[model samples]
Target: MAVNAHAASARTATARQPRLRIMVLGLRGVIDVQGGIETHARRLYPLLARLGCDVEIVQRSAYYPRERRRRGWRRITLTYLWSPRTRIAETAVHTLLGVLYAAVKRPDVLHLHAIGPALLAPLARLFGLRVVVTHHCADYEREKWGPLAKAVLRAGERLGIAFAHWPIVVSPVLKETVETRYGIDATLIPNGAPMATPRRTRHTLRRFDLQPWRYVLCVARLVPEKRQHDLIAAFQAARPPGWKLVFVGEIEQGDGYCQELIAQAARDATIVLAGYQSGVALHELYTHAGLFVLPSAVEGHPIALLEAAVYEVPLLASAIPANLALPLPRNRYFPVGDAKALARQLEVMTQGTAATTAERRALHAAIRANYSWRKAAELTSSVYRNVARGGWQHG
Candidate 1:
């Protein structure tokens, strides 16, 4: 099956092409926040447009207001669809509407970003649209989901793997899981990070009273599996003098975990909750941080970790299989959820010298080579071409 798909992709690559019309669903919205799927779509689609594909992303009207929304970003069109504001209903309802919209437009490909939206893969196929599903992560593993929600997400994963013409997995760990569990040879396409460093600025740092190379940074949504509480506990235990801990993400509405985090942060003046930030502000935080930490208990392919590698910031991450999969030294990893180990590592990092110049240069080069947006775009376009040629349809 893999060989045939590759052959078809090769044929399509060589042939003169028409503009491949693609409709993307399964993101809250783009060009604003730094959610993994949103960031992926924002970066990938613009390059897809440059490669001569006509891309349209379906965003939630609740997240992106109709009055404030733009017509498009770069060469990709943005279509606003209505969904209920609740966490459980938002992705499912938005995807149902987005799939219906795709049916009306009848694009050549319906690209689904995550498993929840890929629940409608069969419906999309029935609409005569080829489907491509990007399995971002095991959503069921998240601590936020209830029993019913986990079951739904598990079913969505099954349906997506069963029905989509081309399934893409973002990490080797995920690819292995899909193959072993479902016997599907999904394509492996990792996420990417831009190589350009943000211009260093004192403005964002000044707002928080932070100094360059004197704060630890973690940029992820304030959710349970991210283990921000564990990070906070570690920082408190370590008691690294003269340095601060900063979190650069926002909490979802009604998330009690976030309130807990807020209370935890309140205990220490050195702990700063910077909230959601992007563009120059986000880049400056990444650029100036003394250490970049990803204490996530779960991940697909972390874009933040990749961004840290791109900036060549020193990293200290949990030793999850996904986090360990990246090219980092053994000394950088600590046991998952082990606050004591993390505190020990934090103390060492805060007191120790920075990474050598040669080490930083090598880290940047390795990351750029391993994860390139251009490479991801080309590979994805190849899959789109193959699917358009009916390579995996009803096979």
Candidate 2:
């Protein structure tokens, strides 16, 4: 659809629709939170607000800024509820409290993100609150979780699929998995990345002591599932001359994986751990990097990869299903977590063209055409209307 058509459609639907009072669960907070789901929320809620939805996102008190926690964001209300930020209990405890608050002051629909928060779908249903679940990813597959936590996450996905008034999946792969396992169709809504601002300055490069087009960049949380070690090993083996390896992301307190990365960077001068960056700094990194790499073993829909594409950076990712969901030339993918294959691929890519002007224009145009936060928000508003009106007879 063209831009005009989307706007016209939005105007038409929102004109007659009753303003939806929505309560959200799942996530630390939207403001500068570093996770994929947080990114999803930050992009989505503002658009929903524009669509005339009364949005109130419940936040964990431990992570969100105290002063602005209740001050709200962009017409959306944010209620900061108490939560013990312990590793294991954080999501469950925060979500339990969120659901209780929802029950007391019932919203039109209680929206849940990810399977962890979706675990309480049945309890929310018992209170007669309409629930909608967005299955962002299968958290069970993340490398950080133990066996018990994995099992719990799986169960949470199951319960959410079976109980929510509407279950939304972020990728086509996830939609298919749930349909086969639970015998229900979920609404498919992929993730989106913002369009890149023109990079006319090298301020970030100077700040990070980086040279433009001389760094291999990977922006993701320093989690084991992200497979940064594999990328480090590949960078070390390939040793692309004059190219430094940079990881731009954050990790939790005392993260052993980050500790390992710090030690590795200490030994190798070329390896730079540039910690979390947002706004213009992140844009600078994405736009100026020599190449972008995502060596993750799993992903629902990688916003980082989308950002790289939006910036027209050369892309190389693991041949995982989620990463492969985006169209790319076959040469861009390596076997998942295989350092040797990545090293060989890096040799082929770094030695040649990153992207032509025509190719970059084509990709930037394609990304803008295909993945859109506006489209996602419009569809979400429709789902809210239906679920609030009890339109879909979901199991």
Candidate 3:
């Protein structure tokens, strides 16, 4: 839909039928990968489009292929902007460029995802764009960032909370943190998880020499805070017969932690490093896995764990505040970074006394009902409408 047409229609509509032109920033491009924020964008914008909104996503040029650049996906326009590839420079530079673009395009709302890109929220607002920031996580707490980077991220959070027309947080813990720290009443819009159909193909399993219901799976970035090392140690200690342990995500560039994981996995033939996977391959792994584990030391409502729940896979996770917030049984949790405790839990799960089939089905239904992309889209669209009407106020 044309920008002018959308704006004109929105102006003519009644209060209840307001259409919005939205521009989203802060993702590393979408339509072909599996990062938490990126996956959220890929699933959300399309649903927003169905709700009578004109949504356009701004992507980093470096992440998109030459052919895929300048194309639209699912009625959402793709606007590519260039940025430096370095971690410190990537989000700031890309968001600056995207803000300038939004300034020219003059969208009804500029929705920024993640606190890193939200550093530019004030700048976007200065250009007369209504800004809505989604606080995906408190990035400064992540182990990867140094003192200087952490300071910058904290500053970003403060600026985003103070300047944006509305702020949304994915988890209740984060919502309370922001409320207490910044004294801002932000909207609580958690991430959604869609139930996936099991893939018919066994190519992903055959490639790794894995068998149906004979392997444990974890799909997360190989970072220190994710604590893949602890999971590896627990799996090694459990030593479940005939079961493989699979790790399915790429390591950060220039990070030596993945190399450590690779060396550790090499000590056992039963362990497989499948690297990054999505779509069918990822679905297959989630579908037939004997168990799913999320050993993260930190998370902002983990999409991987929610996906595992959608597939009805038995779950084992750390007892972090974020993980504990999920609708899971007490027995499914182990002490954070406790390999021995995790091993004991794993042994019990592998012994076939985990959740029964009826319980699994009920859990699956609850998960699907709780996290709905359509509901997220509707709530987000309401935010846009409120911002457009100048009726939104922070408490």
Candidate 4:
């Protein structure tokens, strides 16, 4: 008999509707305040809940006593210890705790996020748990891991891909990488942004005391791989008189990338570093900005870029194919790592062309019409059901 993972099991008549009891694993707890994986899970869970799944979002910290949650700095320290390399020991200490909590809560499927939780897959299988892994980052051989850590993580990724019942990926570049490197078949499900409604009332824009000026907005972690330094150089070279350059998002650990960027901006009145903004402030910034730019050389799929697109803010980004793959038609692209080329693109946007307005509208409509969280949630829910039913097939 043949099986289909895409469809729910018809054999069990008692199964009125597949109760997707999903145990979500990955970057849980405090790390979420900074990373995309955390944000994705937080955004996704409530949508999944509404979709009729019995969902339990598990973080390693859940195993901690209530008293531990109150100690902020100590909690952050413990989280780093819970990183993937240590997850074998970490999971041993906490997976049972995670599972016991799930059992009491009674979940039906297991959906794990991030490469970090892949270390626990072998154990998840031992319990007859169905597994689905969302391959979020590119995790290119060059980027993550030092000499020894790279080799270990590369091997771990291979094992994670092999063991997963089904793998869900965020971009074509990632799906292609997994297929070519690990022979893992993955579903290409792009990331979605919240539908943007610009909050650009006179009061809102005036509250920030900004004049009608064209500015470029760049939102990404201030990390080395993000190539933000290149962006600063490009903005300086472009030298648009009234045009300001603003970068949103926080800096990563040990990297003085943000400080370097600030130093570069010191002489330039046009370049400003607005440290992390969320809620209404973030939305207003995106809405009011003339363009959104991201120069990241490494990405699974950036949520910030997606948010920029949904807002119909004209995008000026690096030429990385994955960044381009997100249905952005009005975008202006520059060669990766080339500050000069990026500067040229910025000049064109600032100069203003007849095509800009039309292109922006078309791109905005395309994103809103196609990329939606509801659709992503529904498709992802199907993957969970497929794995849980033991019907997953390898490509």
**lDDT of all the models against the reference?**
0.86, 0.88, 0.85, 0.67
RMSD of each: 2.3, 2.4, 4.3, 5.6
**How well is each residue in 1-395 modelled by candidate 3, as lDDT tens digits?**
12223334442342458568999999988876557898889878888887768888888888777876767889998888899888789998999999999999999989999989888988987898888999988889888899999999999999998888888888989999999998988887778988588886899999999998889999998888889989889999999888999999875566689888888877889889999898899999998898999999888888888899989998999998888888888889999999999999988888865678987787788888888776677677767877876744452
| lDDT, candidate 2, 132-218, per-residue tens | 999988889999999999999999999999999888899989999999999987888788768688586889888878998889999
Total clashing pairs for each candidate: 0, 0, 0, 3
Off by over 4 Å in 3: 1-18, 251-253
Instruction: Give the best candidate by TM-score.
Output: 2
Most accurate candidate by lDDT? 2
Full candidate order by TM-score, most accurate first: 2, 1, 3, 4
Clashing pairs in 4: 21-107, 21-108, 21-109
Candidate 2's C-alpha runs over 4 A off are 1-8, 65-70
| Per-residue lDDT value at 222 in model 3 | 85
| Candidate 2 residue pairs in clash (backbone atoms < 3 Å) | none
Q: Which digits, one per residue and each the tens of the lDDT, describe model 4 over residues 177-279? A: 8889876678876777787877855453465445443778887767777888888888889887677888777644355666787777787766777776677
Candidate 4 Cα outliers beyond 4 Å, as residue runs: 1-18, 28-32, 60-106, 141-144, 201-209, 252-254, 265-267, 329-331, 353-355
Residue pairs with clashing backbones, model 1: none
Better of 2 and 4 by TM-score: 2
Give the Cα error of residue 195 in candidate 2, in Å.
1.7
Clashing residue pairs in candidate 3 are: none
